[model samples]
Target: MPDEPKRIVEAFSQELHAAYHKAGVRSYEAFAARSTKINRAMHSDTGKHTFVSRSAAYKTLTGKRERLPTWDQVAQFVRVFRAEAADRGIAPDSVGTMEQWKAKYEAASARFWAAKKAAASRIPAMAAAVPAAFSDGPQTWWRAYADVVPAWSERYLNHEPLSHRITSYEPVYVPGLLQTPEYAAAVIRLGHGDEPEERIARRVELRMLRQRHLERVGERPCMWAIINEGALRDGPVGGETMRAQIRHLRSLGRHVQVQVIPAGHPAHDATDGPITLLRFPSSQFQDLVFLEHADSALYPSSEEDLAHYLHAVQKLGLAALMPDPSRTLLRRLEAEI
Candidate 1:
């Protein structure tokens, strides 16, 4: 029973492997290279391509990956196999039509997610049965700082470690994940003016620790930050502190992508407030939209709410400067300070 999801994923992998052989693809490396070539050729004008990594191919073909292949991945696999069959004078349909493979992939994906959901359903009860202090799980990390952080932020912290991708839009101060320690300390001091210095220091420490996720070797989540120009220019943090913060943002490297929306850009959909969207690796969990306010935060899960926030973020991305230009703007901001 515990292995149901694994069995379902493996069955799909077996089908994929059978199709690979039927298409006469010689090896996983060859399949990856051919798929990349085909994708580039098909989308040459747009300069768009999905390069299948050799590791990805090996994982998929061997059923070692825990999650189902994304639709784009499935489509790429089908196209690559079809191309190989055509070159060998074999009917592509003899290997497997795209429609047929899509159907199988969808069926397997549904069953796999269902199995995962069932397994996850037991977790809450299991956790309830165990004493919190004795249990050492992912939640422990957040639990350590719960006393210092606001109650409204609990949900976001809980999901932070589980997220594979995190996209955030900030119109005021720099996003927390990208804030430098000095900037973070200043922000914390301003927000909790009456709090003891010890508490503020702890909060700053928490924010800094949260950033360690970006430093993780391989499991780091992809972070996309869209910042308004006003946030950089008009924050309480200033002087060398702000300069250091800007430099920090500019130096985040590949794991973090930063985009800046110039001032006086056309009014956009996200004017209401800042938002964060967290996406997990598995389909069993729904993506989360976190809307934060001065004294409270809301986690909206309805389909309509999700669609609204998703659309807003998409538009915000378009309105923001491209990454290269954004980095240039950061450099200019840093120098001006």
Candidate 2:
């Protein structure tokens, strides 16, 4: 059994249920029977106990059980579910195989646990330092910290959609949502310089795919971005590429608002690095702030944390040139290049 953070466990369970439904397994009993068959076949000794009861399946999915299911059990679920999905003529290609799903599970668990540990220490420090009044009452914040945003971040963007407004401050590079393909490719290569070309290409593809939310139908969000002047001047991605990127940002118009801070602007509040705040319109989803570091990423939702970032953004805005002027600056930069 994998002892993972509650969020990863919940996501793992949700994946099982989703695959189960897609596989046309309507009841826990049926799913359990199918898994048992696979398990039994694999452990053909006949003396081994391979059967899992329907109650156990239910408990696993709902997280009611005290302990998690064994690794073998999860493998059985994945195997049976994939077979069933294939039988129903649903392409199982994207769903992935048992080993791939297991890899994803392990990755998700690692990310969750890493963030959990960081939050455990950071939250207390934040609480002690910030005013009590700034503490948002009993809020749960999902945090992640890493040099590059993980692949799993796309899931959050898709699941939450554009109804969740994204506000980001980039001190080094362009925000993913506003990046050009060439610019993104250059950035990804710089970060994953040692990785294979295929890996680098996939990273660029995913980054572009994440921008679809802007064009997605129904309740589009107003994405606002604050870019440092350094990100503009710090270009080595080629003059044509930089020109296209600046023009692309200028072209986003109302869909995305871009503000540029001049090179010498002295707003050190956001100098720590990139900061992102995901604000969802739905009451069920609380606003989240994403902070990334060299080694890890944090998703802190405490009132105090959110307030600090919000103020930082406000400071950034104060120091930034407004949209029109920013575009003018971009045009100037593009022309100079």
Distance from true position, residue 23, model 2, in Å?
A: 68
Worst 10 residues of 1 by lDDT: 126-135
lDDT of 1: 0.76
Cα lDDT tens digits, model 1, 102-206, are 899778877876776676555343224324422224445767777786775766786677678999998667999899888998877765879898888889999
Residue-level lDDT of model 2, residues 1-337, one tens digit each, is: 1345566667777776777777776688778677767755654553223334565567666765422344545666777777777777877754568778788766765666575665555564333433443333332122222223454342244333434588889876789888988999987776577988877777777677678778776678878899987577645355677789988988895878899988655552235368888776655555667766433455565676678889989889889999999989998988976
Winning candidate number (TM-score): 1
Which segments of model 2 are wrong by more than 4 Å? 1-162, 268-270
Name the TM-score of candidate 1.
0.58
C-alpha lDDT (0 to 100) for residue 225 of candidate 1: 95
Error of 1 at 216 (Å): 1.2
* Pairs with backbone N, CA or C atoms under 3 Å apart (clashes), candidate 1: none
Which of the numbered candidates is closest to the native, going by highest lDDT?
A: 1
lDDT score, candidate 2, position 28: 80
> What C-alpha lDDT, on a 0 to 100 scale, does residue 311 get in candidate 1?
91
